[model samples]
Target: MAKLQQTLDDVRSIELDNAFYVEDGTWIESLTVASNTEFDPETVLEEISGVSLFYSSKIPTASEELEIRRLTILANESYPFILSLILRQEAIPNRIVLQNDVFEIVATTRDWDQFRSMADEVQETLGEFELLSVTQNEEPGEPLDSGRLTEVLVSKLTSDQLEVLETAYNHGYFDVPRETSETDLADELDITQSTINERLRTAERTLLELIYGPRE
Candidate 1:
């Protein structure tokens, strides 16, 4: 069994956006974290023998205080603690975060066995484990990789269509109560109401086809 490592210290939180097993035990991971003190993950990573930095960005708060940082690292060690076994399952990790002292990992697998195996591994190595919630995705039998979600979504939707959809989503247009309407979207996008409707309709169709598989 693989042991869990603190991996990082002086960190408020860490969110693993995407990760992939390259070869051997090496893995590539992208993450965003918030820290209160002066803690550079790269320095700690440098301490490890087989670690390389691909990209890094630091974004501060409105007051110019360094609060959040994003990094993509390629390392033989699985950064936090979960990757020891997480990499084995090939599950699409949703959000892997370290809050306080506990690690919360949400991921999607093709079947129940895969999820169960990962959960089992966590319990064995991490000592403490919690099974929060497991529910089927909206599109049954349709498995979408987190990496491909963005690439495919962008390729299918034009910029204008994407902009409108993003605006609607940000303003809660898709809420059950319908927070915003076509007229509201048109005003926000500075486009005609008819155009707003058309863009949204087309975008929705393309998105649905991608998810549910094109209509026969």
Candidate 2:
């Protein structure tokens, strides 16, 4: 048992510099990569089952010579280690940030036991990469530093509302030049424009209420 625990700890501490875990079982990670590397989205999807390339866009930062690509990946069931864990229990892949060879993933799971089981499997299966740390949530998936107001606000949002909001954000509908439009988003989601609009409006109102409180 002691050896088992040590193995778990080692797996958890392997890629400390590149991976992070949130209390809510959410993992936000940054993968390392070589400079000037380009990725083909379809190829990447073929290689990894748990990750999906949602949208890819590039923008010039303050350094005009430097351009950064923002890739939004949805991990429904791709990464082997994460997939093993999710199969052991219920989990959700929140987000992924990919650059070159490095991939940053944000995922959430409510079951700790299943998570541990997944870690064990990762230790046995993944030999190329490392696992950094596993942070247990005080109140699964809730940020430790968040205020009560924020919690209440998030709690009030329905799954559909959250989905629409995330879709808009991911597709760059909210970007300055707008990478995508409502009609495009609606088509992607196979939902009507009116339904998407209503969800966005409701989600926006809920967020505003959280920031400024209800209207007088």
Candidate 3:
């Protein structure tokens, strides 16, 4: 695990935005683009064969932040080369978390050979990668305290539930004034309003149980 973290850090150090382990043997990352660079989602999807783009939205306001776009990609068919290597090592990818220019991934793997293979493959693919320090069972350089709550909550939620929760939070669904509506969130996620409501309710129930313990 340490070796894998080091490899991921090294890959990200080379002008990439950010990289980290999510959970369940999945990895997600993003590249830093210049402010003037034109982004074409179709082109990106074409280039990375095994990855699926779930959601792409700009942060801090779309017009104000042209250089950064939050993207959620799921590893599906083994393209992107890295995904193939990880799959070959028998690792399972979970989900991807994108924040501004950084991308975080969750994955699970028990085999050292898999980690080493991934590191080697990344180094070979991208020149100028650097090896960094790795912490046990945690994303590289992240203190366990800061990530524990999220990890725990994430473990209890399905991927769709997590995505809906995150989207709601991002859109201020829980704000005092509620900047966005359930309908709007559904539209953004391309799901029905009832579906969004059910997911939110279930997610909230799970979260509350986590916070206060199960009710009698």
Candidate 4:
């Protein structure tokens, strides 16, 4: 087994948010202690204001891998909604920060009691690691990525097809209400549904190809 690395030192406290527990079907604390720690999302961004965070934890068992995959899909599905909250200024602090060691986390917050409760839950779930403290900080950066991912996503599409994807994503067509229709989109793009579908299929296939590499 891979040994746990040096204990996390710089973490000021474990952080949590209302979304933390809800986004995934299971409670965040329900996750194995072996895999997670308390993280304050805001203070973390302050510590590494410019860097993107990446983290991974061991899958001690098969069930845990399934859980992680579910959690990842849930997070991805919820990202645009989460981001809209920040963009509309409906939610406090826009991002959460975590260390690559998978031992520390920084989260955005507005309520102290809720945050405290989250910390308690995390410390309980992620045994051994301790929650030290929470502190406030200014300097929230732009909520959206600099379009690197979007650019990459769009690059796979023709200019006209890219426009459709952006329009769908922005209008939340991919979201729950299905605000936009194929007819509406076809009218706007001056294309038939069959053509639109083909372009989108090409775009999606290319995007996946880029992300996962060509098939074997």
Candidate 5:
């Protein structure tokens, strides 16, 4: 997927189905979710990438939506070792902040994509933000502080393995369709392909260890 860093301004929100979300004139760089609202990844991705990549409830009951949010939190906690990208919103003046494990971005009123309901009133953008999409944008030329999720992944790695992983991500080794081949990385790192593969395996194992932790 393409990573967008551009800011969008003066956008209104449209509510549909059982939920409400924003649609920007341009591709969305970030979106915020209130702590109180349910986190709907499908709705978020639909707005951002303009495509729905997962399941969402059509005839959703209030309890069902709440249950979905609970499930998301549970999944994140169950495997906290996995990197997560989160967008938090405040409602006072309509602001959005994007957080990765690494850095936080505070966007202006123009930055937020909010939920709209006829019965509800929005006083600020910072409060009770909605949950937007979850993505992996750990490469260069994307967003500043873009590597929060990657940092989560790195947190699971040893210092040395983290170096290798960071190199792979920054050098576009992990870009979709793969901008750099294994042979290219092998040449750049002056190591054999077998060695690179071993490093990657070791890194993955260590991350899983951090996540599951001895399985006891």
Candidate 6:
């Protein structure tokens, strides 16, 4: 508990996120660094000796289709123990920043055997390891995109609209051949087809606005 409390106070760290092997003896990784000081992302890349940055970008990177690598660097980071508390409960600690030099990378491991294998492999690049904590989930996949969903759903859609949209989505109403139709939805809700169509269109438009912002 003493070691844990000390870590909670002040720490600096680099996180190698979502790393996985792409091929024989090679790994694809997205690395993140946080410290008490400001450092240029470009310059930091230059400082590294041998690793190839397939691509790099600052946090809050929008869709690649909308924007590429940003010019600004994530500077003056205060992300330590505090960030751990604030982050979503689903997120597991992958790294613990020790003093100023330690990389704690959390990856989605299905089981302990897999985690041990990964830790052994990661130790080669990171240069040693101290197993701090491991978080197991009954579901072994990434969490939902709740950030965007929450913002759009809460502010824009009405209760009726949300119910309709949820049903349509769950039933694959938007599928290529359309898994379910307005007629089916109308029947389920005991509403007219015309009413169903109107609600769906309005809901769809609201969702679109979330991505593109309000219409011009």
Give the Å error, residue 106, model 5. 12
Candidate 2 residue lDDT tens string, 97-184: 3333343344555666666655566556654445555666645442221222333554678867766776787689999999999999
Per TM-score, the best of the predicted structures is: 1
Report the alpha-carbon TM-score of model 2 versus the true structure.
0.34
Q: List the residue pairs that clash in candidate 2.
A: 12-132, 23-137, 24-141, 31-102, 49-78, 50-77, 50-78
How do the predictions measure up, each by TM-score? 0.52, 0.34, 0.35, 0.34, 0.34, 0.34
Off by over 4 Å in 5: 1-114, 117-156
Cα lDDT of model 1 by residue, 7-81, tens digit: 555566766666677887787877666665556766766766777878877643321223566668886764444
Candidate 3, 44-132: lDDT as tens digits = 55555455565554433122222333444553322344444545666654433333423344445565666666667656764433445
Kindly provide the TM-score of model 1 when superposed on the true structure, using C-alpha atoms. 0.52
lDDT per residue as tens, model 6, 91-131 = 34443232344443444555677666666655554467677
lDDT of 5 by residue, 121-157 (tens): 3223223433344333333132222223333554466
Count of clashes in candidate 3:
12
RMSD of 1: 7.8
lDDT of 4: 0.42
Error of 6 at 178 (Å): 2.0
> Residue 32: error of model 2 in Å?
20
TM-score of 3: 0.35
Find the 10 residues in a row with the least total lDDT in model 4.
Answer: 64-73
In model 1, the clashing pairs are: none
lDDT of 5 at 75: 14
> What residue runs in model 3 are displaced by over 4 Å at the alpha carbon?
1-144
- Candidate with the larger lDDT of 1 and 3: 1
Q: Write the per-residue lDDT of candidate 4 for residues 1-216, one digit (tens) a residue.
A: 001112323332222222333443322211111223433333332353232223323222222111110011112222223223332333344333233444443445556776665555555544544555667767544432322343355446676666666555656668787988767767866889887677667767888898799899
Worst 10 residues of 2 by lDDT: 8-17
Better of 3 and 6 by lDDT: 3
